[model samples]
Target: MYQTDNLKQKIKLFMIIFFPILITQVSLNLMTFFDTVMSGRAGAEDLAGVAIGSSLWVPVFTGINGILLAITPIIAQLLGAQEDKSIKQKVQQAMYLSVGLAIAILLLGLILLNPILNTMDLEYEVRHIAKFYLITLGVGIIPLFIFNTLRCFMDALGQTRMSMIIILIALPINLLFNYIFIFGKFGVPAFGGIGAGIATALTYWVISLLAIAILYKVAPFRDYQLFSSWVRPRVKEWLEQLKIGVPIGFAIFFETSIFAAVTLLMSAYSTNTIAAHQAAMNFSSLLYMIPLSVGMALTITVGFEVGAKRMQDAKVYGYIGISGGIFIALFNGIVLFAFNDYVAGLYNTDPDVIALTVQFIGFAIVYQLADAFGAPIQGALRGYKDVNMTLVIALVSYWVIGLPTGWILANYTSLEPFGYWVGIITGLSCGALALLARLIHIQKKYRNQIENSSAT
Candidate 1:
């Protein structure tokens, strides 16, 4: 009874943190959805332009964010150790890093823009519009990174509601801007999809500035004095963040790129196939937010406990997070599976797209549990600062094993798109199992270290 009660309490705590983060994530995604929808109304060419631009930007942006994600656990650990004095310095260095990296990314994007577009063989109009969109959006990258840096800092300290509220405020603002700019409302020139990019860029600046103000002026955060003084960037601290962050960045890149690759590969099939795949992927991605949020909360909790030198408690929290994630996954899987047709219909009215989407959803259902397991385990690893192995596992599981199997099944066999999804299932399962094993091994290793220290 005690164990059960403890698990319930832990789960409750996890949810308390998870839901707000989940809402923030959903709001961010909704911003993108609004951009896409509004751009689509402009024209097919405009839509394709935004889509192509997004494909280029999303991976790079996601990679940068992943790298910065290291700060979350680092901050959590600092707070856990009650080393509040050190927090400002670390955040300052992170701010410097974020700005520097953002500028570099922008320059790189500019340098690579023409070359990358040339290789895509896109229609001239599409290519031209995409170039404009990229350039416009590129201007916002710095603010985006800055916002993310402060957001991570706050979330690590368990101040999620503020960030969530800020993001919520931005969503409607983003839509209003998108409408005005995309349609040239109130005398604004119709920049079409490029206008959407402009609106998003402007939104980034707004949100980042708001976040900065909140961190500096908000009552809960005022005592931290996060911006009290700028610290010169130290090589050792930057290296430390890179050591933990680069692998995480690559891990995220690998996962997102694989899905992108699959979508590109599916282009070889019928338009209906592509549409169906996208519909299924969209819904599945939304469902994924649940576990992702829980996983992030677990990272903070476990990192805090570990920093406090409470390894057993960390382990307990890790298990509770994993268990909670699995339960959520089970529930999502059943709902998605049972309502596949009905849900797919929500995205499209075409009978063919609907049928194909339902079929794809079936595969998503099978792997939902694996996804749930893998994501939280990864989070737990991050909390323990055990991140390098995750990159290796992801590489082997997704590329070496999963992608090849998928390619062969997709190309050599009649399974086609279904085969690719099967590969996803295999990869996710392998990743989940591998991550679980690593978590167990690390827990035992930490326990032994503590035991030895005590005995000595």
Candidate 2:
């Protein structure tokens, strides 16, 4: 009866924590879906253009944005410690840090843009169009980064629901611009992929502005002097946060690069196969947002508990969040398995493309469940500031095993697209296995330490 009651209470707490995150993550992914559909309407090349650029850019920016996540643990710890003074400074410092990270990525973007596209060996029209899109989309990086910083700052304070409202506004605004610029529906001339880039850039600024406005109105800490800090930044605070954040950034880079590399390999197959992979990938990405959000909540919860010295409760919270993630992922996996045809059909109009998409969707459905198998463990590791292992795991997962296996199948054998998805499954499964082992090892060690300390 005690166990039963405990399980029921966890379900209630999980629902409260999970729903808002699910809504926000889903909203943000919806924008990406809308962008893909708009690009699809333009042509195969246009679809390929955004895919190529985003394969590189999305992970790059998202990884950089992870830097600002320092605020969550910082704020959670301070809030637990009841240090209202440090909380304000920490938030201000995080903004500065986020902006710095964004600017650095912008420079990297400029240098990396052409070389990355050039190496792809695309045709003249395709390269030219893709370059234009990459450069224009690169312009949006600063706002996107800054917005992510602000969003994380809010999320740390438990006001993450703000992001959902902002994206709700940004969605129609992005679609309207896409309609106008992609087709020249309004007086604007048709620019296809380039127009899509501009629409995306404009929406970035709009969302950032809306985020600022909402925060100023609602966040009680608006009085904090970000630009004119009462004192020079405590360098120690900045360094501590970066120490925690940079490894996380690289961890994300290594994991996401697996997808980028696979997509590059997928180019070996016919264009239809790539399109099919895209449909399934895009669909899987939407589902991934759920687990990702749960991961965030788990990380924050664990961090908060650590800050408060509630070690046992943190352990319980980790189990609850991860278990909730597994349950939700299983349900999502089932739905994707059941509805692959219908979901793939929504984006893919080509009969051949639709057929290929079904197979890719089969892989996607399984990946959704595997996501639970991996991401939550990574999140728990993050809560403990143990990220260096992920870097090594990434080396093995993406570069050593995944890439080579994929190449052998795509180039050296007949498995083709099926081989590509199989390689991803293999890499994720191995990575998940490693992460689970590490998580158990560390948590048990920590529990022993806690027990000894209390006994003393």
Candidate 3:
């Protein structure tokens, strides 16, 4: 394992892992950013449709993808323990699980998606765009799931720069496709917001193919023979991973679904309201990538430390990650506060849209610090494999506390859409505090166990 005793050494190793992951994360999110921007340019209806479609898609994607995410820490810990023999088999099993989950999600979408959209009071264009956007996006689901499994494997191995490079290659292709489809370049029909879906779906395939090639061709990766040495699907291994994955999946789902729920709620309001909300949200999500990357980095770093029985080193990584996340959020807040209008304008030029987006960004500013605080700790806890509490915390803090507060405030008072933002801020703050306390308890418990063992 890398040196963890020296603060500088730890920080150096952290950065080595962090920077590529940061670029990879931010670049991936930029796909959404481009989608929103390009769709917004197409028209308000286009933007709203894509936004609504995304609201539905994101939670499902992340929740299921979160299951695949377990491979990262699982492999990281295995690496730390120098247990390399089972690595290839574990990844193969994860691939099988990813395929199964993708099939399940697809079936669910077919059964439930249209009904859910139908229940929402959306504009005709918005509804049409949203429906087709999801359908088009669906074509890529299997590949995307496969790709993410590969990504988690690579990330766990700390081959993040390779992931970063693959995504960077995909980004421009996504952009080009989005333009061609959205604007009807060459022979393609104008798809508007649905084109963004087509673009994203195609991008998923591209990245997945690229990732596979890398695994096949790369030195250390090829040594694992990820493709040739496929392991048969075993229920026992699947259950073991699902044990780790399901809570992580649900915790991510709960948090993401809160935002989706809020967006769905906003459907009752004007299309302009939904557009403005989405614009602010897209920009905020872009900024969120910073702390989020920190959190992701922590998962690998701290997981390795904990797996190596270095409790203090794990704690140090957690502290550094959490502190750095909050500090970066503060810096993001300053940027948002100073240039809220400019950022809002990037999404749309409609005066009302820009104005409301600016207002929502204000709410975002208030919560940046809290979001930063919570996210990294969540990552840290995952490193410790204390995910059940993370799931409970997310459920209560987001659904029980946050969503309800937003609903009441939006309906019972004049806050409306802004009220939802307030609720998000409240939930994030609560989750942060709860997670911090949980991390402390887990750390102490592990430390005591280790100490007692040493004494004996």
Model 2, span 40-60: residue lDDT tens: 777767766666666777677
Measured on C-alpha atoms, candidate 1 has an lDDT of 0.83
lDDT of 3 by residue, 371-438 (tens): 88898998999888889999999999999999999989998889977999999999999999999999
Give the CA lDDT, 0 to 100, for residue 183 in model 3.
88
TM-score result, candidate 3: 0.99
lDDT of 1 by residue, 132-206 (tens): 998998878999999999998988988888889999899889998999999999999999989989989999998
Sort by TM-score, best first: what order? 3, 2, 1
Tell me the whole-model lDDT of each prediction, alpha carbons only.
0.83, 0.73, 0.92
For all predicted structures, in order, the TM-scores are 0.92, 0.92, 0.99
User: What is the TM-score of candidate 2?
Assistant: 0.92
Q: Pick the candidate with the highest lDDT.
A: 3
**Stretch of 10 with least lDDT, candidate 2:** 1-10
Error of 3 at 209 (Å): 0.4
Residue pairs with clashing backbones, model 3: none
